[model samples]
Target: MNTQEYMSRFKRFYWITLTALLVAASIRPGFADEALSRRDRQTGFLVVAEDRGFIGNEEIIDEFQLFAKTRNASLIFVTDERTGKYLRNSLDRLLKKGAERIVVIPLFISAAAPRYELVHQLLEREKLDVPVSYTRPYGESYFAVEDLADKFRTIPQPADTNLIVVGYGAVDSDSERKMQADWKRIAEKAAAGFGFASINILIGHDKKKKDDDAVARTEKLTRELADAVNGDGDGGRKTVVIPFHLGPKLDSMMSFDARLQQLLPPGTKFLADGGSEVRADANSATINLATWLQREANQSQPLAREDVGVVILSHGSDFNWNETMREAVQPLMKQYKIEFVFSMADQPTIERALRKLEQRGAKAAVIVRVFAMESSFRKPVERMIGLDIEGVAQDTADVHAGYGHSHGHGAAPSVPAPRIRTSLPIQTVGGLGASPLFAAALLERARTLSKNPARDTVILIAHGSGSDHQNELWTQALEDMAEQMRKSGGKEFHAIRVATWREDWPDKRAPWVDKIRAMVEDAKTEGGKAIVIPARTTGQGPEDKFLSGLEYDLGSGFAPHPMFVQWVDEQVRVGLARFADIRRTGMTTVEAKSHSPYPEKWLWW
Candidate 1:
């Protein structure tokens, strides 16, 4: 369809979808109106994210602002999760204004899901009812699920079509069943209509069993599928595989895909070019998500090309999966007439990406995080990438001159300095965590989960970090994003929680072993409702053993969490989006700031 036609259709669908949502929502005994009505007083909020040993998940303040703007609610207290402290001292002012609720909303997605849960827990313990609900996932009305599905349908059909649906499987009670059920339905439905004679579904596994579990399981399954295909060629059968995830190149799934391919017989045919691969640093994954969301929001109308600049920010890594991620995103970057695109970590930090746009003479840039929630990774990114160019420039100049480099270095410079480019207006977009866009993509995932309702509770375990602040950032993002499942879906307040490894043990504590023990206690008390999502950048290496340990640790606290959990899936998606953003910008530049000599009070580590 033409652009105009697409927009018209989208508008109709948007309203219809919203109407369906409200209709569906009406039945849910909406929040107590009287309780809501009691919130009549007005109060301004004093928000602050603690700068911990590493970057904390503070970016959500920006997201919360947008979300709050939509709801027209006032924010009262903003504090850092690390310190559990607020930056601004506006408590008395708010009380004087007759503010009834002192809502302490955490910007981190998973660290605190429905603010209300934490608020409820605190209220019950303290005997109060200010009622603070962790803001749930941004509902799907504005996100792009149906649109993403349409994109999936657009996969080119090959004559020998065989399909495989791959994804980061759930480890907990609720999610694993959901994933299996989702895949079965999608595969069955797709196979029936698409004329595929054979279909295979494999959930990437990374538990603490044997050394070769992933390789063995994938090889065994693929071989089974190949064996099913009748090589007689009487126009009788065909086979195809489609990854259920947004990217196919991710290490965990890719490792399995590679092993499976190697095991396939010579005569077996596979579809390599058409299927989606969810790899870290793949721009296509985020683009696919972005395009899908636009379609759902009725914002897909081809905006003036100059008006849109897509910037993807993610927790980048130095791994083979990072390369796979880059490969997957190249096509989308070339296809779209994006004003400017860039990624963080792979050569161009967000600062450098903005510099490219500034050089291009663009008016504005749309910055999006491929990640799932607001965490340390993204929190520092906001300060690093989202400030006004003017402010960055000032900061750069102050750093340069303060370092006593004010002397003219125009000629042969004695010392080289980092370059900072100024001249771009940036707009920070919310990360994919429960954003409407991802909700659409995940709906497919959820639908599958629902079919397998036998699973207990869903636990998403990410490669949380205690090692460094950077690691905590990524984990926090996943934790935050997991909250969406509770906000918009059918699950209850008690059904879902995003768990991380590092948080299980604070700094100065034991490593994976202790973290596992903590989660074990949490799981037992919570009715064994835990599903795991490995949080490494891509599913690879010993991380899986650590990620899978969470389950084993449940009863015996002897096992450690798997390194490769679903959190990694989310991180890879975030990385890919950022990679695409960096690709569009040829090069990046960041001016080095000058710092005063260490104060006498400062001690060396």
Candidate 2:
């Protein structure tokens, strides 16, 4: 009853314990090399990055993986330019690996609605023989916009100040026509939140392709819009231009907000809506992006520190936004060991971020951007990082351009940086262009237009002009939207398919009216839709209204990223809140990446 029975019981308990350990090891990562290996072979998610191939996708994939890891989800990534074979192979691979529930999210923005039809067709065909679900691109996600708004809400507020949202506004085609129309609506609704007597919205335009010339155009546009806001007798109004761009380097280059000070109507007051290139506010867009991702992952525990980090990339700015960006990302610095670096603009860019992480101590890094599309951004980011992050680069940008040719990310030329070698692992996540949160922000912005009780033809515009080889492609792709709107049920709209005077519209020809008439006719013939959109990224100007105003019921407007506006507002508030946080927080938050010591290495200097 003592020794013999006790020995027998011990033997049975030991066997039971061993069995439990084996089962636990099978379900947990790092338990056995074979365990993770087995899961990789079985439950990996299949990602098809149908992009123009930008480096940003690599970072998005890395972040998505990290997010999955935090939630103990495993995935296998497949990156490829969009093609039928690629999609078929990817689906086949996932199906063969026993994928039970697959969610296919296209990285392109314009493809959002069209891709749904494609997915439906494929699913009907039963080509993959698996349950595959397709999400409406990245930026379409509501959380994307909400997170951006939340981040903006965190910025400090100014006392008794008026804010004007500014961004690249000019449209050759119509990718963001709906978004522009939507943002105007959002602006009108914000009065209840901001408590301003009346808030005005403006978009900046690039009169030409050259950066300096574009700057001039932005200045002129700002002055004109300012006049529309508060100026009396054409002197123009005094207002703050809040940039709504994703990357500081690029934003500062063409964004009206950055050039507003230089472009202000002579003698009119213009204040920095937020911080500089190295301030937390500068990187608020990325912060909002990450917040959206964390939610997407739906983690049970807090997000893994490895899952988030500062991804400093430029859209190739001539004036570096690195220092200002560093400052903007400071809030996360103390918590995350810098993990990644690269630029959409400059060279010594993302490469430096990765090397910096290796120099410090990081197993891997996640890369992301606050932008909305992923055409050119993917290749550069991938070249800087690599395809090892589950090989499934994710991004917020929308991927498919309805008829092909998409708008790729851009920046100034890159400058090379030092490299480091370490055993620590690294991976890349891509752009956050179409993240659901960003889409929600667009919707919020759309609400702003609803405030116009007069029921005018809301024309949303952007400032777009570029000398780069890609500009023409973007212009053609962007400006032709009457057909798309007609397809979507919009009619009687007066939209101008023009680039900035700086980019391509300098001729000032009267034939442009013929173009306007063509679009109206197309809209009527196709869908009986009537509203016209100038869908530029910047602001509205005489040039923007050029031929359209003479037509029927044309009203001009701009669609700056609503969250960006909110972020600027928040930055102002944060700077003013508890002066201690302001002073102690440091004037700039940029941290030197271990791989690159120069502040401007990742941006144009």
Candidate 3:
């Protein structure tokens, strides 16, 4: 137990401690690198442009790449119309680099451009397994309009000068026509904001077989425009030619502009510049494009139309309900001028929305009712506009015959009727009713929850009215929808039953709830699953509250689905077309009623 023994024991203990420390270090996990890897996952952006050398093309690519880098995503640029080989190579490289997702952004004037379709076709042919998303071309975006307006603000107006906006025309006649029409619209909007003697939109692309003939036509149009400007006054009037385009000016367009300048009469003053073309590559526009791409990527869907106004009307209640409805209709706003309105709630009423649409100069207004069946709101809406439309009335005399009360919570309240009027003709379409579209929607929901429809019973539930006539209508509509589901479902379901929230005359809500519970219980006893489909506008409401604790799979109500939106669009089209027909043919109310889809009893005009 002297110095030698102490030294040996100390050495052994030190070695053991060192070995344990090394083992612990080897097992320890490094999380910093893993966090960085997730934060820097590879994202690919395939920019499809018309021409490689087009003005601002390089700038756009650079801006987009820098933007992507900020988001830790990489970008790959490919000129579409120039060649297919380059695009293919770019896409292949992006895939080989292990990009998690690739987003294709067409740097074109309009989504309607043929080049946009070409990119889509090429992508479809490639059939890459990687997740891909597409964004609307820059021209179709409202951001483009804003960019143009900002650019227009920089120009100095002479008060007597006429503004001429020119667009690169398409080879296809229809495309050229549409392009011209769109350019004219742009010119009108731009002119409205500025004081111009007159504005004209000239198409640079021509359908003529001979280039010389096209040039001559262009010369004549330019001369005519110049003449109009010069004839406005003896002198001091100037013509400002604005080349409305995205990038490197085409040789053909420059030559045409030269010819237009030369065709002007002696002593005529003219100036031709890039005009709003510079805005294409501006920082604001680039930021807008970046923001849009990010949003589309997050949502997994493109935005709605920015030109058309859409009013989504629903029977709103709480803040949560309104917010839910807003989230549901948000995707539609991407492409449309959309506003959410509450029929019975506060703020942004139908009348307010109609005025807003008029102020926005909306080409058309679509009033979409998010209700399932015909409600008391419709009559009030019609009366507000001084329209007398006959609608389904409850037969109170037959109340004892099993129909409920004529009026209840569902009835429209007796508020002072709004006298708001509009010069724009209104088209009041019915609710979901018993349309085939609603049937299809219900069937889809059923299939989503059905494990084995062959051993499942489906129950269609609606917010039934206390009115005897209304309940009858609801029952008939529900039965028709159920029958449709059966036919389309093709024996997948064992049976389908239709029920309402309100019970017959003597009994109230309890009987209907009991009936639904019994149906579910019977289905379960028979070794079948019960699927309850809410036959209302939205998935929310009293259906869940009324049928709580029932062993059943509940399907969502009709709103928020793409099919519902399509139905709304169809209704808008039908209503607008009918109004147009009535105006064109000078048709009487009776004549219109004869052609109406709704029953004559329901027509109040």
Candidate 4:
């Protein structure tokens, strides 16, 4: 071989070796898995807090870090004080790292804060393709109320001690007004937990000129604090002041507190001010977020082997609606292992959920029907769960058929026994029928839309069952609700009527449409407004579709309301009590000829 030929051969071998190494690297297990993992990881979180200074900002960042660690999610922190450009830059970094779904949580005290609007506007300008969700600010949650109450309990005081909280007022007039309203609510909730003689909030800065009028406003607030402490007729009451700030150690907050203390009356005392707006030790916002993320993560896990398993049964359709149901039941997740089973339109049917629960070693199970009434839906559920009817009249003529029965027909069809039986005892409970909590939720929905009850005609609308008998039962229940409301001041309305989506047989829903339109027109002719209330499990349902283009106001359905949760909790308690009774009496099963399960009428309510 000549020198030129040897050099050419060496170059060819070098190229061939390089190509082989590249192919090996591409096929390596760990390297391929890492790339796949990066592609698959879609969820991330962005936490934004108004950064006044280091102490407050660091606390928030630390809390967010804890949340991110627990959720195994990527997190980015930004301050509202920075320009929108800066926030966009930070968010861009997260997106580049392969986060397709981002949840933005604002650390502000109120959901109405202007910072949220700014963040939203920035997202629009960037026009990011990934889906993003924004959580309402920290103060809106029931957990926040409880956290505030717990903080108030930590303040050592006499029974007659008055409480005063001071906060940094917003510069904008509208924001300032909203902040005042929100703070007043927080104060009321906190005071309710303790026997405070009185509670009030004083702003440390002026809304018109945030920085320029700070000193003058602090002086004014100090004087107001003095009056608040001494103006009450009961002269012996002492006043305690707390810096209601996200970062109390900030220079401005420290100066304001010092001035207020100097001007306070002799009997007034100031609480030790060190923590942020939310107590670091108490239910911090980050801690709450961590818990929420954990619960969400648990939704995909195999059912835990536990003492009790709760199956939240709902008539699920849209995936979004199922998500809403999941969120609504979050508070209960901490106490019991939970699995959701949809009656329709979703995976993991009731049969599947029960089998999973049994496999997970659940000693007993509870079926909490997330519905507004016991109607056609309940029958199938009973049959699926192996519950047997007991102690009802067997004769076709004598059986207690639900309300509007047109009898003298032939013998009733026989209901097959439950298809699946489990060793674990199961107790199925009725939906939110005729419960006081349900009535209260309905009233709240009505009052929210009513401009003037005395001038507005209110209509209670529900999704009635396919059976005429079941429709009659629903109508009677709504009538009973209307009567209760009428006795409790709902009579102030011009009139109240009960209407159902399924009024009769196949054409039942057709009549209600015209009836609703006429009712609205009649109310308009009489110089009154009309309000329609959706008496169902959730607000996002047929009411909007049926009442489209109508001039009347429509109210929301019952789920996600605190009262709805209360109703669910009450049912759980009742189911457990019944289960205990059954065990004590050694009654494994009840037998009746009727197709409907459960001997007791209340259980079928």
Clashing pairs in 4: 246-277
lDDT digits (tens) for residues 309-355 of candidate 2: 34434332223333444444555567666532433333455556656
Model 4 segments more than 4 A misplaced = 1-40, 70-81, 155-159, 206-210, 248-265, 273-605
The CA lDDT of each predicted structure is 0.35, 0.36, 0.55, 0.56
Report the lDDT tens digits of candidate 1 across residue range 240-316: 44434321222233233443455455655443323343223222213333222212111211133443445554444
TM-score of 2: 0.31
Q: Write the per-residue lDDT of candidate 4 for residues 252-362, one digit (tens) a residue.
A: 332334444555667666664433333233323334444333322222122323556788887676887788888887887877767887663122366678778767756
TM-score of predicted structure 1: 0.30
Q: Estimate candidate 3's alpha-carbon lDDT, on a 0 to 1 scale.
A: 0.55
417 in model 1: Cα distance from truth in Å? 8.1
Ranking by TM-score: 4, 3, 2, 1
Span of ten consecutive residues with least summed lDDT in model 3: 24-33
Which should have the higher lDDT, number 3 or number 4?
A: 4
Query: Candidate 2: worst 10 consecutive residues by lDDT?
Result: 596-605
Residues 36-64, candidate 3, lDDT per residue (tens digit)?
24323454556665432322334455555
As for TM-score, the candidate ahead, 1 or 2, is: 2
Name the better of 2 and 4 by TM-score. Answer: 4
- CA RMSD of each candidate after superposition: 31.7, 28.8, 24.8, 25.9
